[model samples]
Target: MLRTTVARLTVRGLLGSRRGLLLLVVPGLLLLMSVIARGSSADKQQLTATILGQLGLGTLVPLLGVVVGTGVISTEIDDGSIVYLLAKPLPRWQIITTKLIVAVLTSWVVAAVPTLLAGLVLYGTKDALAVGYAVGVLVASTAYSSVFLLLGVVTRNAVVAGLAYALIWESVVGNFVEGARTLSVQQWGLAVARAVAPHGGISTNVGLGAAVPLLVLVTVGAGWLAAVRLAGLTLAAGD
Candidate 1:
């Protein structure tokens, strides 16, 4: 069970700030584009795929991941307030787990919900496109939250690193390079989406066999490593 106090604190830190307003911007634009696309005579499948895949999964989810995931721990670490939390008797793993849950839930609310709404507006559940991409967004958001949270623990420049990975590596390189696609979280997510939708419009280079294990590894490994790192923070500061 999540400690209600830690979870509540994390939720407040995430939603009760200007960053929370910024998080809503992209999702709003996604919905607007969906509304506009709904009236157009363009192909619905192609539009849904492009909007949900490129904008929803590609841009919004990772950005939100960076914002929410990093914000959870990095801000406290930076402001020197994390010392208070560490000084308490709480298990290091519980703190990391609580924050991870917050980041994942925040990412889901901001990114996945909008993707689902956009998919519905653009395609109206046709070909299971909305549900497919929503599932993709959910999976991608979880992975993004895990990886970005690890970055937050390890680096002050977590947002920059996340952007470099998401935009530069995943968006630019993963598209042109075959090897890069195999290593991409986005592709892993698309693999899940492809399974759910099973439509040709939603393409994935990775298979479920590979994607599921990779997702599990990344999520569990990152959380475990983050807990280890946090456990040492007090000792490192004293030394």
Candidate 2:
């Protein structure tokens, strides 16, 4: 029941709307950059790392997650339409789970698939960089989608906040500050890559054991919090 409605809303928000175009744009840009870089005198190892670490996971994954995750509920909340659904006989957790599932799947497709292809184009299976980064993107996408989706439910400036977290915290601070790296999803995913990648190819500040726990905790915690938030969600009236 609630799951069905949330599923309908999630799919519609993903594929049956203008926002779908934005989803298309991110992956298209990744592939385009991969193609253009193929023309240059780029070192395949550096190129693959840059694209996967910086562009694919660092930029596109979070961006798409913010868009798709927030699109599932924030738009409805913004328009005061969620009330109709909330008024029904449905548990809030069901809605949250359904939307979260949609967000996770969408994020994987837009972020992870292109990462593999870009990795292939750049590295050509060298040192297993392609597969490693692909797996990293997949794992990171799940965690990111949950975090951003929770943000969507709890904040009006979800996109702004998500971007700040993705670009400023993860990209800027994670690189400059060693401590920040341990707390970053980018680093955690990189840890996963490090475990699977050929020796000395992929590396992260956080180890695989720590990263796996953090990923699961953040994802599940955010999702549970979102369910609680949704249960008591209130709409602001336009004055």
Candidate 3:
């Protein structure tokens, strides 16, 4: 069972902050765009792909994952409050796992739900476009939460590093460099989306064969490493 205490603390830390309100911005914009795009004469498939693929999956999920994932642990670490939790006799992995659960659920609720709702409004499930992208967001959110959670454990600048990876690496380099695309979480997510959507509806650079294993590796590996790191965390001496 998940540690209810840790989970509750994480939930409060994430949802009860200004950053939590910031998380609403992208999803809100996505829904607003979906409503406006519905009345335009533009092609439905293209609009869905552009909004859901580029903005929703590419931008929103990762941004929220960084905010929520880093917020869950980094804030505690920064304020020296995590030492109290670590001083307990509890297993380290349990704490990491509990925080991971909260981060994934928060990202899924904020990002994936909006994507699904927007997809429905934009295309009304005509080609399963919304469902497909929702799956992509789910997969991407898990990986992002794991990776950013590890970053939170190991670094004080988790948000900056997460932003660099999401914007510079994933957005800029992944698009321009063929090899970089193979390693991108967004590309892996697109591969999953490609499988669910109608033929030619979704596009992906990496095949499902590669995407699945990479996703599993990144998500599991990052979480495991974070648990190990937390096991060795030291508290500074009180002056």
Candidate 4:
């Protein structure tokens, strides 16, 4: 369901916007924090967990998801230019999948590189923390991209809605409301990180049994939903 033309346009739109600046700025900030965290005399493994697990997987990935996902199509929808795209013979699902691919790749590049680098800086290759979180980021970015891309399709406030979901639901609620942790992308990613770093540098309430299914469900379900929504697109509705 991928289309080269749709993919090219989405990439150009994403890079030409302020979201491109964010793609650079967020990674720089992550690397800078890794430098600062490196000097800390705290327990290295635990510190690595906190930095990469809590901040990297929990915060940064989803934030970039919001920016990249929404950037791909929300601007077109908001400006009423999506009508031209819809007028084309391309299947709506193809459009959504192509944009979802762009969002996933963009979010992964900006979020995963710094995560791997920061893991190296803080706790170098031990327990494979660097690779683990990078893998975790890949999984989480795919799921988050699909969800936020759906948000972009269905709502004018996709960015704001995505931020609230990332911060409030994923971060705050997932922390305090222990039961809700099962529903979070952060927890799903942590499950992967926990498996990869089995030497105990990281921990998570979620396990592969729950996380794997949820990740697939969310990613596939959201992509399907976004396609369904886009198939019904009208200029007035898109805006």
Error of 2 at 47 (Å): 1.3
Using TM-score as the yardstick, the better of models 1 and 2 is: 1
Candidate lDDT scores, in order, read 0.85, 0.83, 0.88, 0.87
Clashes of each: 0, 0, 0, 0
- lDDT: which is higher, 2 or 3? 3
TM-score of the candidate numbered 2? 0.93
Q: What is the TM-score of each candidate against the true structure?
A: 0.96, 0.93, 0.95, 0.95
lDDT of 2 by residue, 52-75 (tens): 887787777877877887888888
Using lDDT as the measure, name the better of candidate 1 and candidate 2: 1
On TM-score, the stronger of 1 and 3 is 1
**Where in model 3 is the C-alpha error above 4 Å?**
235-239
lDDT of 3 by residue, 1-239 (tens): 33898899899998899878877887898899999999989988998998898877877777888898899999998898998888777798999999999999988889889999999999887878899999989998999999999999999999999988888877777667888889889889999988888563898779999999999999999999999988878433232
- Winner on lDDT between 2 and 4 is 4
Q: List the residue pairs that clash in candidate 2.
A: none
> What TM-score would candidate 4 get against the native?
0.95
